[model samples]
Target chain A: MRAIVIQAPHDIRVREVPDPTIQQPTDVVLRVLRSCVCGSDLWAYRGESARRPGQRIGHEFLGIVEEAGHEVNGFAPGDLVVVPFRWSDGTCAYCAEGLTTSCPQGGFWGSVGSDGGQGEAVRVPFADGTLVKLPSAAATDDRLLTALLALSDVLGTGHHAAVGAGVRPGSTVAVVGDGAVGLCGVMAAKRLGAGRIIALGRHSARTDIARTFGATDVVAERGDAALAAVRELTRGEGAHCVIEAVGTEQSMRTAIGVVRDGGAIGYVGVPHGSGTGLDLDAMFDRNITLRGGVAPVRAYIPELLPDVLDGTIDPSPVFDLTVGLDGVADGYKAMDERTALKVLIKP
Target chain B: MRAIVIQAPHDIRVREVPDPTIQQPTDVVLRVLRSCVCGSDLWAYRGESARRPGQRIGHEFLGIVEEAGHEVNGFAPGDLVVVPFRWSDGTCAYCAEGLTTSCPQGGFWGSVGSDGGQGEAVRVPFADGTLVKLPSAAATDDRLLTALLALSDVLGTGHHAAVGAGVRPGSTVAVVGDGAVGLCGVMAAKRLGAGRIIALGRHSARTDIARTFGATDVVAERGDAALAAVRELTRGEGAHCVIEAVGTEQSMRTAIGVVRDGGAIGYVGVPHGSGTGLDLDAMFDRNITLRGGVAPVRAYIPELLPDVLDGTIDPSPVFDLTVGLDGVADGYKAMDERTALKVLIKP
Candidate 1:
């Protein structure tokens, strides 16, 4: 089978790799129907995050179960499902409390835990907890699979940001990124009844798609100009909720500054790779609520899958391009080069 | 009329000043039945905050309405009333929003644009908004009057802290600072139905008082130790709500450290005179909600006054010492020296 491998910084290759087999009693082998490189993947690709040889990377995917281990009872071979990025036991105290990302027994698929998901075959542990079965569709239904693939990670992440920000009906929300995930955040804000959705994006194409995803306004101006624009629209009080989808010093500050006093600030962007500081002096006076670290993706996938099935929220607008395993290297390149909103990969 | 005047820092003198008279249609002249020195008063007495020559220096008082301006009909002559340290015009936008301290047209008494409350007689402007007329028995009840004197500031400030923190039934509250305000916070938490109240204080007397006011446990600990104590009681999740009463770096950090993930923090300690910083990095991961600055004490007095009237909560325990008008200097010295929890000045 073929897989996209990071050869080094700025060097990615689509190369042959052995297919995965179920390794644990609870594990299920997924024949990848669709997968995508996340925004975090670009960090290592751009040399910001350390890259190493023989390391498998991507974590977002939807697939047909090729095999299920003995202990996995809820899923069976050939079942269509969305595989959330994190594999969890689902019985840990943290997961029980809806903080799946912090679950002591749960671990991320691609990061310091098990194998990555961007391949022809990937083994998912604790299938009952991590995989959400979708209604079976024909193999030719690429669009539905691609959209469901989004719910596995980015869409769930966007909803996490919206929920953490405590967005409500007739509430104003500001989303601070133009990436596919941020576009999904716009969609999530819309689904959650946010009155005004402001997408802070520099790219014209991305902003247009963001509007389709429920962004009511576009803030092309970066940093202070963008925050001032948001505040101006909000009668100088700023938005009721702001999503920090870009994890940078500037973006974090914008998230804090653009939220109204007593408002909520939710961030889904990985602050791990970015050098950002939480200036409490700035946040304290405004009395803002700061929440969200990593998206508890698994917790959301179950609740959001129905919305996707019912056409309540189309998470597919994010898939700007599609590629095969052989084209996955170019997919990463296109996203890193800012030419694609997101590139869906089929194995 | 004899009054306490801070002619300069370290130079408080009980001197004969002109008798206060009603000067505005909404003003009322109060014959000061009781007054007290506050911890904030020491900021000027110790040369921390700016102090001007011949300026009267107290803001906490309970007195009888000796005379009322023609427009002041809510309280008749001889009606006993307790004052809110902050005098708001009641009709201002900020006042309507329940942020009387941030009232656009009102100013802090003794600082600028307002008269002082610490003397034999006081000319209280916006008397209708500032005065809380207790039920008739308060005129002869010394303890209730002294506690009502507390309602002018500390008691009101405590209610502000608890309400701002959103304390309710089953809320696990941690009260930082064991002063009169801190003790009042403990009582307010009980009144608000906090299942557990942890009082962080250094003094034995104050801790005992805290216990009396429904503090389930006392942390004779500061900062890290205090947070540890609070966590031990909370099954390692710290507190559901935190009230920050001390305006210092250490106390502020303690407040942040002692709250659970997604818990709320309310601060109202005048912000260490200038400002203070928060632990944004840890707070982001914890998903904490931070609220409070200068409390709108006026907005809270209306609801709290009745509780004091019916003796549902005894705010009187805060006054550990009492003195006559001539002993006002002694009152200031006792509070400054930490010899009294609070010193009630009788004029």
Candidate 2:
């Protein structure tokens, strides 16, 4: 099987790897139909994250069940499913609370001991806890495939930010970033009945997508200017909710600054950078809620799947480019150079 | 007139001072009947916070309105009132949202340019927004005065912690501290209908007060030991809500440590140390909510006052020591030594 592997910084390759087999009673094997590049992947690709030679990469995938372990229930071969970024045992206390991302038995894809998702086939641990089965009609709908693939990561993460910030009817939300995840955050806020959506980013192309995703206003400013613009839009009170999708210290601070006192800032970006400290002094005095970590994509997948299936939302626009598995390096380049919002790899 | 003045760390004195008079159209003069030394006041008393040689000190008070400014309405001479720690213009956007502590025109008592509450008379700015008037019968009700005084700071702050953490029916709450504010947190959790209340502190006397205030369990351990105890109580999942009343980094970390994933930590202790940073790495992955600052006492006073007056809650027990204005230094010493949970000063 051909899989994506990082040989070194700025070096991605598609090499033949052994096919995965079910190793545990609850494990299943999946034939990945589609996999996408995540923003976190860029950290390693740019030589920022700790990556060793020949490391398997990627965590987001839409796939078909190729084999199932004996303990797996409600799933069999040929079933289409959305695979969350992490695998978990469904019955743990954290899983029972719908926080699969924090499940004690959970482990990330493409890590030291686990098979990566950007491959022709991979072994999935805790199959019953990690996969959300889609209706049979999904197999025949090419137009819906990209959006379904997004459910594996970015879109669900955006939803997590919105819900974490307590977005509801009449909420004024400020989404800090215009990346694929940030654009999706705009859509999530709209779906949750946010009355005003402000997208903060400088790139015209990304901001355009943000508008399409239901952003009511776009502020192409940084630092104090961006904070001022959000305050201006919100009648000097700042947004009722802020969705932080960029995992930088400055992005988190901007999200905190533009949120009204007693409001919330929901952050979904994987934290990066050195010395990224939340200013407890400011957060304490403002009574602002800072909530959000990794998204529980498994928990959110079920609730959001029906909406995608019914054509109520199409998150496909986030994928600006698509390529064959052989073009995987260019896919990473396109995203790295900011020429594409996201790159989809058809395996 | 006389007022409590801090000449230096550990030096408290009641000295002759100029009588307070209205300085703004919205100001009102109040004859303070009672004032209390707060945990935060000890910070200044210990020379931790900025304090000047002749600075007026207390901020928690129950008083009788002796004079009203022309613009002040619904309050007049001889009306008893509960004065919050801060004052605000009732019409600001934050005030409208019930976040009076963050009101644009708000300022804390004893702060530069503001009169403190320990004086015989105080010129209260934003009288309509800062003072909650009690029924005239309050003057004759001796038993209710201490409880009413608690509404000014500690009790209201505890309530803020519980409410900020979103305490609700069936919520399992862990209170970190057993000071006056922490004991009050137990009561606040009870008032909010928390099913199981865990008080984390080592003092037997304070724990007794915590039990009386409705703590179902008391964990006297500190650091990781305390975390283990809380985990043991909640079936290894941690508590649904954690109220952090101690401002140290270790206390903050313990609160974060014991909170279940997707749970909240409501902190009200005034931050004292430099570089008190929340580990966003841990918080981001666990999806914990860190909220709380200064309590919006004015916003909460209305809802809590009736219960105190009706004998439904006896917050007076928290004030274990009583002193006259001349004994202000002893009041600070007693609390500093942990010999008294709190001290009430009769002006």
Interface RMSD of each: 4.4, 2.2
For each candidate, C-alpha RMSD in Å?
A: 4.0, 1.7
Candidate 1 lDDT (Cα, 0 to 1) = 0.80
lDDT scores of the candidates, listed in order: 0.80, 0.88
| Per-residue lDDT of candidate 1, residues B233-314 (tens digit) | 9888888799988777777788888987767777777666213446555665555666665566777888888888788888
Docking class of 2: medium
- Provide fnat values for all models in the order shown: 0.19, 0.78
Per-residue lDDT tens digits for candidate 2, residues B1-347, read: 99999889989989898888888879999999889889999999888887989888889998999999999997999999999999989998789878998988999899876778887888999999889998878777777887899999998999999987879999999998888898899999999999999999999999999999999999999889999999999998799899989898788888888998889988888886422546778878888887788899899988998888898888999988988888888989999998988999888
Candidates in order, TM-scores: namely 0.85, 0.97
iRMS of candidate 1, one decimal? 4.4
Candidate 2 Cα lDDT to native: 0.88
In terms of DockQ, which candidate is strongest?
Answer: 2
**Fnat value of model 2:** 0.78
Question: Which ten-residue region of model 1 chain A has the weakest summed lDDT?
Answer: A272-281
Tens digits of per-residue lDDT for model 1, A78-103: 89888878777777766787766655
